[model samples]
Structures are given as C-alpha cells and as structure tokens.
Target: MSGKGGDVRELLAQYVTNLEDDVFAIQNLQGVVGAVMARYSRAETGLRETLLREFVKEDKLKLAKAYKLIERVLIAYGDDSVGELEGAHLSFENISMLATKVIEHRRIGGSPIEQSTRYVRYDFKDPERGYHYYCPESLKDTPGEAVFRDRMDRMFANYGRMWQPLNQWLERHKPVEEAVYDLGDMGSTYADMADDKARKVFERTYRNDLKTKACDILRSFLPLATRANVGLFGNGRFFQHLISKMMTAPLAEASHLGRRAFEELTKVIPHYVKRARLLDYTAANERQMRRLVPRLVPELCRSGRDSGIQLLRPDFENMAGALAGDGPVSAQRLSEVWADEEECGFLASLLFTYVRAPFEVIRQRVRRMSREQRLEIYDTYYGERVTRRDRPERGIEFGYPYTFDLVTEWAVYKDLMRHRMGSIQFQALVPDMGFHMPGELEEAGLGDIARETVALAEELFAYLDAHHPTEREYAFLQGHKMRWLLGMNDRALMHMLELRTTPQGHPNYRRTSQKMHDLAVSLYPDRARRMNFVNHDPVFWSRSDSEARQRLKEQALEGDETAS
Candidate 1:
C-alpha cells in the first residue's frame, strides 16, 4: 500500500530528534505508560470490552501489556532506535510496532504546538484562483412539433453556415473517414500540448476544419486556475516551515501559499505553529529591572532618608503609588531611582520597591560594601564587567566591570522582561550599548561563538559552586544546564525550584532559573518553598492522568538510580 499518510509521522519524528539524551527518552516513556495504565486500571472497565449479544466482556489486558512493553523498549533504546530498527532483520509487524511505540511516546509529553484559528484574521483569498462554475447542457422549449422543427431548422442553418468551408473541404478531400481522422488528430486541443509545434500542426491540419481548430485555440486560452489543488499536502509542519520561509520570498505565489498554510496550521498547534515572536528589548519592562535589583543599578539606593521606607512614613507613598499601576510594575522606573547617586543615602528608595523587606536589607548591606566585598559575597560569579565608583551623594556606584556576549545580553534582557519591570540604566560606551547585535553565526561572525563559549563557561563555573564536587562531578558533567544553577532567589526563586528544576523540565530557561533559586536559598535558607513548573504548551495537555503517574514512577526509579 502507498503510504500517503507517512507525512503525518514526520511530526512524531521531530519529537524523537529533540530527545537528545537516551535516558530522558526512556524515562519519559516509562512515565507515559505508567500514567496511562494507572488511569485505565482505576476505571470500572479500563481494558474490558463488552459483548452486546452475549452480555459478556473480553479483557484487552494483553494489548495494554504490548503497548507498555513497546513504550519501555523505545524509551530505553530511543536514541539508537531508528538505526537499530534499520539494521535489525525484524518482521514488518515488528517495525510497525516500533512506529506505534514512537507515536505513543510522542503522544505522552511530546506533541506539536497548538494554534488558535479565530484570533488570526486572514484576508487574501484571491479571486483569480478561487471557486468556479461549469455547465454541460442546455435545451430550448417549443409549443409544437412544427415550432420544434422550425427552431431545429434555424439552428442547423446557423451551424451549416459556420461549417460551410470545413464541410466543403471535407467532401472534396475524398474519404470522410480520412478527413475526420485528420481533424481528430489535431494536437492543439490537448491540454498538455502547449508548444508552438503542437499548435501549428493542429492549426494547419484542421485549417479547413473550423470546429477542430476553434477547439484547439480555445484550449490554448484556458485559464491557469483550472487546476486548483496543485501542491496541497498533509505535511503540516513542512507546510508551516515553508510558509514561514515564503512570507519573505519575492514570488507572490510563495508568499500567498506560506501565509495561507501558516494560518491554517495555527488552528491545530497553537503554541508552536505561529510566526516568529519578535521581542522588543527596549520596552519599559526590561529597563526597570536594574532599579528593583541593586545589582543591576549603578548606584545603590538606601531604605531611609531621601528614598525612605514608606512603612516609616505612610504619607510618603511614592514607592507604592508608583508601582500601583493598571498593568505590570515597571522595573526600569525602580532602576532609575536606584541608579541616581543621591538616592543611595536614603532607606525609602530601595525598601518599598520590593515585595519583601529582609531581601532589600541584604541588598543594601551588599551595596554599602566595596566592589571586592560584594564580589566576595556573590563568590565572584561574573560574566560581565566588575567595577565601583564613590558617589558623593549615593555612597558608591558598583558596575559590572566586563562586557558580556550578546547571548548573555539577550538572556538577561529576556529574564528582566519576564519580571515585567521598567527601571534600569545601561552604561554609556564608546560604542552604543543599546544598539543590538545578531545572536546567530549567520548574522554575526565567528567572534560571537568565542564570546558565547566564554559566557557559558562562566555560567557553568557559578553552577558548580554549591555542590560537593567529588560526589556530583560525574553526573554534573551530564547535568542539564539549569540543574547547575538551582536555589538562587527568594519566593520567586523558590517558585522555580518548585516548578522547573525537576528532572523533566525544559532545558533552556531551567539553568538560568536555577540561579535564581540559588539566590533565594541564600536569602532564606530556613523558609524556602518550592513550586511546580507546569508545561504550559498545549501539546502536553492531552496526556491522560495515568501517563503522568507512570512518568512519576519512572522519575522515582531514575532518582533512586541517581542516588545510588
């Protein structure tokens, strides 16, 4: 059988491609099966099918076992599966089972991003390539046989007039069959024959045959819209990727096709299937983070005096008043207050801007210390510049001494923006600091790779600080980038610790977030709380409860192994 639907399997393949670690693939599989089995077993007739006529039931327990076995095998050898299956002289049934295993694994925690249809408004449904109507027959009504005969006579008279030359030529040509064959053999009327030779042959051969030549000429003039579903296919991801590429293509067809496909696929994969979401780095939320966090500010503000705490003086509600907006609080505005040299002398400046007070006190204490002292406290985790300047009014202005790679810059910008603050100040440079650079090698040069490498090294060094290097070194080498930076903040840090630091977390943001968790632990070693980081992407939403449970079981097993 032709695998017309094989394209659908490619999406499943993409999920496997991302399972870079074989262990993760297996753990995820175990989790999926465990979760599914738990849920089904708990139900009244989890695997049992009812027989209507006999009023009996048959258990599908064996099928469920087969499914679990497939899930486990795929997870255990997932990274080597495609190759192993290729080399193994397995039966077609075995290969089919393997495919099913892959799809089943994908269904658990791996699926395509979901998209919304209603919100995306599409406008360009071109008229030149749209709905058309065709009619095959028409007839005339008459009062009587005489009337009908008269009409028929008129029609024949017109037809005879039209065909007079051709009819005369045919009669003169000798044999009717031969003349008819010559007329019928005209190639121009064939839809596929677009060449001038075909047109010329048909025209010359049928010149005396008016009807045939007319048909040939009409065929050449047929609208390009006659063929509608030209390149349509079921490969949505490929279609989506193509559409994304075509949006910028010079050809009208490419752009139109891309935009149409993108819009259509969005309905199915809402989270992952949309156009690129370009970030506005200069937005207020990003600018404000430096103000709220003392480390981000050039000049450290104090809790009392000019920037005094509101708790001591409720009449001075500027801090609370400033933050009480309809939308999110701006980190840039807070950074501006802290960045001012004169603002550092007061208690109110730094205190009220925070949700908690003790954290602010620790920050203020760090601010009062010299650059070296603050570095000593942070244990010297620096990717950027480290410097300090004595401020006549604000006490001191501590700055990041080293310039960071664009990756760090973008990463910091993304993090601060997520905080939704607006008060931060960047230092003036001989070259403009706010002017952005491309993050990718294609956009930048090899220099970016070097810078990124150094930055990543710095991040890993910071991550290794908390653990007993002797015991954890082996696993630490294989650690997800986020696992290195856990327990860096207060509640916000704890929130992530509770959420994303688990074994089955997203890889990108997890490390940076773990750094936040680390900071939290330092501030509140006694009262830290953790939160769960739920995968908000719609693709994971369809997983049954049992699958989730199985995942937990697998994680427990993995965790026990790790402990050993």
Candidate 2:
C-alpha cells in the first residue's frame, strides 16, 4: 500500500476482511499488519490516531518501526499469544490423501475443505502417465518402483472398469421413481412432466447419486498415495506447530510437505512462521515413543487381534462403590455429571488448562471439595457462553475422557479423523488385520474384486517394504483394517455419534457411530439420554433417498411443485 493515502485507504476498507485474497497475504508485510492493529489495544487513541500520532508516521508505515514491535513481543518477550493476532490462507493442491489426513489431524484451529471422494470423479487425468497418484522419490531408484507403478495402474484400471457396472446396478435397483405408484402421482406435476424431462432430471441427479455411491464404494480401492486437495485457514501459531509436527512425522512425505509449506509461508507470513522448524524435543520424543512403546506396553509388542469398538478402560467397574453418587441428582446439569466416576473429574476438568497444577492434584482437590463447590466451578466455567460453538473452555484436554479401541477400514479412519477434538493412536495398515467388506459390495458381488485389489496392494507393499522401509503407508488400500484408539470427551463423542450416525452417511461409519452411541448410552443412560439423534434405522441406498429429498426441496423452492 503505497503512501497510506486515499487510494490505499479505500483499498484497505474494501477488502479488510477478505484475507483469503492474495492482496492481504502478500501486501500485509506479514506481522506488520497485525502489529499495527494490535497496537490499538494497548493505545488510548483510535487506529488512525495511533498510526499517525504514536508511530509518528503520517504518510507510510516503515518496516522496522512496526515489525520490530512484533518481533520483540513474540520472540524476545516470549509471548505466544501475540502470534494469534495474524494468520493466512494456505492451499495444498494435489497432495497425497495421507498428507492431507496428517495435516488435518495435526492442525489446531482451521477450517479445512478437502476434495471429497464422494463428489469428485476419480478418472485418470494429467501429468506424464495419465494417472493421479503421488510416487515417492524414495521409490524411484528401487526395484519397488515397477511394483508400485503396476499396482497403482491396476487399481485405477479396476476403479475405471467398475464404474459402468456399478452405475447400471444403482439405476436398476435405486429406481428414480417407485414402481408401486400411488394414485397421488396423477396430481403430481413431476409425475406428469414429459418422460424425457423427468429422465433428464433423473439422469442429472441420479448420475450425481451414482458418482457419490460408486466412488464411496470404490474409494476403498484408493491407496493413500492417491492425490487429493486440501485448503485451510489457520493462525501463525497453528502453522508453526503444524509445520513442526509434519517435519517430525514418520513418513518423509510429511517432512517434505512441511519444508515446502515453510518455504511458501515465508513468502506470505515469514515473521509469524519463522519458528516453524524442526524442534529437538518433538523429534527426540516421537523417535523414542516409536522405539519404546512396544517395550513399555508388552501387549503392543505381540500380534493382537481386532476387537471392534471395545471401550478401553481396563479392569473397569470393579469398584465396590463404583455406582455410588453416579446417579444424577434433581439439581444436576448434564455438564456436572462426571459419568466416568472417581472425583468430580468433569468439574475439575474446567481448571485443567488454566491451573498449572498437575491434573491428578486438581482431580484429588475436586474429590475433596463439596458438591456446591464443584457446581460453582461448572457454572463459572460454562454459564456465560453465548453459543454451543464457543468451544466450552480450555479444559477439554482433560476431564471425563472415554477411549475406544476401534478396528476399522482405512476409509472409516479417514472420516473419523475429521473430528480432531481428541487424542488418537493408530497402528500401520497391513494385510494381516484384513479389510472391512461392505454389505453393499458383497451383495453386488464386487467384494471379491475389492479383496483381490487389497492383496495386490499388499504384495506391492511387501515388495517395497523389503527393499526399503519408507512409503509403506502409501501402498495401503483405503479398506485395509487398522486398529486405532479414539479418545474423546462427552461433547466430542456426542458430535461424532450424532453426525456420523445420520442416515445420509456411509453405512460402514454409520454402524460404528451407532455402536459408539449405544456404548455411551449403555454406560451412562441418564447423561446420554438427550442423544436421540443417533440414527439406528435400517440403511439401504441412503444416497438415493437423500438425493430424492433434495430434488423435492428444489422443486418446492422453484415453485415446480405447484405446477398443474
């Protein structure tokens, strides 16, 4: 913005909120914009007055004058909160699904829009070999390169080959109109429309439904190597942590992406993201965790079998007085009930982040405190919140936590990971754990083909792992089973269960969501009573029905429903 005059002022006023525009990202001088704005908080004067009077510059902002302030506050004074004052929009295009998932999981506060396999056509397109997949640089020199290429080609080929047959099956079974017609159709305008026009709507919408279902089914065949897009908006602090996390990830793809992201962010938010480097603590901790977890937990060292959705509190409920004081009182709110038992754990949770004391200390203190004290803490923590979206408070890191051992397909894992409000631990997806065979596929007789593709990918994975240990995850079929632990608090669990168990969702995840909800309900019938949104109805061709409802809504909005 040359010489903060009329033109620059008008430009700033016009596009102040639209940070997604490149204009804000490139021209802000990164921290300079945030620094100038942050000054108004500490200053007694208005923004224009602060800029002109305090900075003592009427015409323009000098870099050293404003930039130095941010550097001092953030770097020298060691105030991390200052980093939250600025952020930027970043787009990751045509990256691997693995990379996108890792990014989403690691990211703190960001709205991420990912390329949906349900909506996007998975046709082979562009770049050298007419296939959309990420080939690791590590595989280029190895004999596994041939195996990788062949497996990817075969998967894509089958994905393309099955499209027509799948569509035909959808059309024949999920008919656009019910065969057992009602007399009400005689008065229905949509029913009276020329068969050709009806066919047009059916072809368009049902074709959309077809794309959604077919891709959802065959998406199991998609390897983690398949290229996907993700765009997110995050603050500088978020980027710093996320970048450091990726840099230390198990796969080199994550580290490479992190470096590239760091380089690009330098062009936009250089000062804010300067600390986005490999941290000694992060690398050392992760390396040791990987090395010693098996030794620390003897069960982890051995071959363990899949146990679908087992609630993971070992030697649980043996307490002679476990149920004592668990029953909800007449005056109790849902938030006050520490359903997990022992101490007013839920109430003490609100102080988890704010207090520097250890969580056990807080829990014990709460345990000794009177009922009124815990109630007061609960009210003080959450009562003044305006909306449910206010994120409760800082103490979500602790309090009333539930852990579930999940044996699910890679497809379900990707969907589940979207709820990043909890801690997660997952093992590698190998052929030994097996795949999730959807009933729809088994009924359609393509179940065998899907299994065959997993075997093909497994063979490639074995070949590649033998040659070198890198990029084995890239070979993992999305349907391959892996055991993962999802640890969430009550609110997070409710959100996941209510959302994923909806009829419009994929059947596989829907079932798991139902099971999670059922488990919660069985465990705490009183606390989870309000969780009636959990859909336990029979699901079949849900996309078809969902699309049909959408069509009716569109017709009503367009006034076509009133047509003669």
Candidate 3:
C-alpha cells in the first residue's frame, strides 16, 4: 500500500481502539460489563474477534458494535431513552434540490454547510457541457420535460451572456481602490503596493465582487431545480427524522434523496435509524393543513403585490431611559456588563439548586439588590474572560428583544431563513410582489432582457397560481418578493446582523441587515453603540476563492516538505 494509505489505516485503527475503550468504560459504569462479557463469551471469543478484525481490516467497523449495544439498551428501556445518548456524527454530501428543505429543517438538529451562492459561480457550464440542474424523474418522459429544459437553458444562457457585460460595468462603476480605506491593514498594504501590481490585484478583486452581485441578481432567474452541493453533519436520530420527512415530501427529488440517504445511513448506523420510515400521520397532517388553508382564507390566497420592509415592534421604551446617559457604551464596558449580568444569573441558578430558601424569596432578594451592588457582585464572580469559552451565560441575552417585518426578494429570504434561532413567519411565495432587477444587468445594457425574462416568469407564475397553487411556488423566480415576520432576541440579532452584513453577503440581505442595525441604533442608541461588528465595507474576493487560495498554498508547502 502507498505510504498515505498506510498512515490512514494507522489513524483508523487508533480511533477504533479508543472508541472500543470508551464503550467498555461506559459498560463498566452501568454495571453491565459482566453481562457484555457473558454475551461475548457465548458468541466465542475466537469467532467474534475474527469477525471484528475482518470488519476493521475492511475499515467499516468503527463503532458499529458499540452503537448496536447502545441501541439495544435504549430499546430495552423504551425509545424515549434514546434521547439520553446522542447518535454518532454521520456526514452526507452531494445533496441538491433538497438543499433548502434540509437546511431549513433546523428542528432536525443538524448543522449543514451548503455551497454558497455568494462565493461559488454556478453560471458556468458543467462537465457535460450543459447547465447543472435537478430534473425530476417524473418530468423526464413527459411533455413538461421540453418546457423545463427550454426554460432552464434560456435562464443559463442569459446568465452567461450577462457575465462579461456585468464585469465590465462593475469595473467602470464600482472600483475596488475607492473602498480600500475601509479594509484596515489589507487595504493599506494594497494601497502602498506598486501601481501596476496594485491595479492587477484590484481588478481581480473588483471582478469577483461584480460577479457576486451579478450572480445574486441573475440567480433569481434560475429555478429551484438548480442543483447545489450541501454537506450535512448530524446525529443519526436527527437523520432519521429528516429522512422520514423527506420520504413524505411532495417533491419527487426529495423522496428520491430521502430514500438514498436512508439506505446509505443504515449501512453506518443501522440500529439507531431503524425507525426511519414514512409515517402516514405526518403525511395526512400536511395534506389537511394544505387543504384547509385555501378554503379558510381564499381571499388571502390571491397573489401579486409589491415587496418591502416594515418594522412592526421597535420597543425601545424599556431601555430608552437606561441608554439616555452619555454616548454609546464602549465595547469593553458592554462586554463587561453582559458578562456580569450572565454571571449573576448563573450564580443565582446555582444557588437555587442547593439553597433551602423558598424560590420566591430568593427571586425577591436578587431583584431587590441595587444596580451598583449587583454589578460589583457579578464583576467579582466573572473576574476575567479573555476567550469565548469564558463568556457569559446564554440566559442573559433574553433581556433584549427585537421584531421586524421584512418584505425582500425570495433569494434573500432563503439566506435569512437559515437563521433558525429567530421565528420567521412568511406569506405565500408568489410573483404578485414585483421582482428586483439586478443593478449590474441594467448597467450591462441587458436591462431589457432581464425585465422581459421577469415578465415571462410572472405570467407563468400567474397561470400556475390560478391552476396549481400548491406547485406554483416552483415557478416563482428568485427576484420575486416575499414578506416575512422576524422575531428574534439580541443574541440572534447579533448573529444575523454580523453574518448578513459581511462584504461577501448578498447585497439585498446586506441592505436588510444594515437597515435593521440602523433601526435598532435609532431606538436604543446607547445600548446598540457597541454593536460595531456589522461590516459595511466592500470585499475584493468571495470567501470561497480566498479559502481555495489558502488550500493551494498549504498544498505547495506540503509538496516542498515531501521533496525535502
């Protein structure tokens, strides 16, 4: 075997040995070591060890037996006990049309890293010299196949055609050097470089930024059928729930993906995911909900409207007085205060666990303390927190609440929907709301073509809405507007604002985040003064490009080491 393959085998063996040791330790703790030994002896050590060795040699039995044992114990105690133990991490790749569904199913308890629309350019031709898309099997032999193909082809064609003009327009309109002052060290270094070299670097960055913006707008033209790679890392229990839901989904692609995922997952963690099957209860519930919706509110079911943002509850009264003092608080002071508050809660909860005092008395005593006294107590409790691991308790964040009503493009909504910590309630996905045209498209002189395409999509959406309302959403373009009600606390707001306002974020969502931040500051300027993480500067390259360049550099270093 090659050196690398042998090294990999060694690592695998070490991992398996450690896992087996952990299993044995747990069994001993549970006082089941004797029972486990008895079973192993009955199976005969020679045969059992031989089978295990063969499985290990094949590199397939990492924790299979341990998982099986855990599964058996859990089942014996009742399925409810399964929650006590987290299943093994199972990774999945090449998941496509099901990307949105899988990612948005945050209740399934998994983390998904999907191919970003901002970083990866999907407008290019595939290896097969055709656009990459997910064509439903049901449509393959039907008359609709021709329509689907033609529409997808034209969408990709327009996307490709707009590329050059969009880049050229961006070069003329949004120069990179103009925003160099905002990028700190990187910008200063670039600014100080030789003129010719700086220009070259600047041009590359400009083109990347331009492409991202153009793609953001152009992506609206691409249907949901466009394939996207998504990597999922989640436990078997969550996978079981996800697979069951997918199997019952109305989409043919979802059903196919669910079946394939289930089959593959069973190979690794068979016992834990054995219960993954389509439940008629869930399917019937979905059917009834869909059927009852239109019948109960027929007028609300109608489509066609303009999209925009509306801030519903900007409750600043509670904190307005507290923040009325001097200017915004310093970042250090803000962090100190937050840490202190969280420490107080942590101590209180800890005391509640052991104290003989009545809960109401304890609550009253804590509440009656002077603000200064409380701050001092908390400061002593949390001496120094230089790292995130020493940060404040999560409960402290519940003090700040924010609510917004947003009407943005469907493409932007998809990005925001991934922030599952927030409650995102949305209206129907329809083209009733006028779509957003890409500014680059207008600058590229493809404004007419873009408008025409949107018009065509709108007409088709109208037809679909009237005839097939349930499936009409598939016809809605990315630029189509949809309204959503967002309710989130300060912690969720921090994550959404900081993430969505990054230089690489979609402009539409970036604008939304900026608006949100602006609104928050306006209401509670003192409290939000230190919420300075929002990025308003421009970026030269997408994050994907940056990561790829880093990977190449690392590979070069490895090659040099190997040569030495």
Cα lDDT computed for each candidate against the true fold? 0.28, 0.67, 0.57
The Cα error of candidate 1 at residue 103, in Å, is 37
lDDT of 3: 0.57
Candidate 3 lDDT over 1-564, as tens digits, reads 123335443434433334333342221112222123324433644323433443234544434455555566545644533432444444444444434654455444677767766666666777773786655565568666566566667776766777677767766775655533222223433465456744455455555556666666678776565677777766656777778777877765677777887888777556556777775654554454445434432443454345355444322342344345748877776556456444444343322312223222333355445676555444533435653324332222232366565778878877887786865545556666677776667757989878766766665556545654434555677777776656677777888899888865666788888888887787667755567898766543434344334444654686699999
If the candidates were sorted by their lDDT against the true structure, best first, what order would they fall in?
2, 3, 1
Maximum-TM-score candidate = 2
Clashing pairs in 2: none
Report the CA-based lDDT of candidate 2 relative to the real structure.
0.67
**For every model shown, what is its TM-score relative to the native structure?**
0.19, 0.77, 0.65
Which runs of model 2 end up more than 4 angstroms from their true locations? 1-31, 46-59, 125-127, 179-199, 295-299, 314-399, 545-564
Question: How many Å off is the CA of 529 in candidate 2?
Answer: 1.7
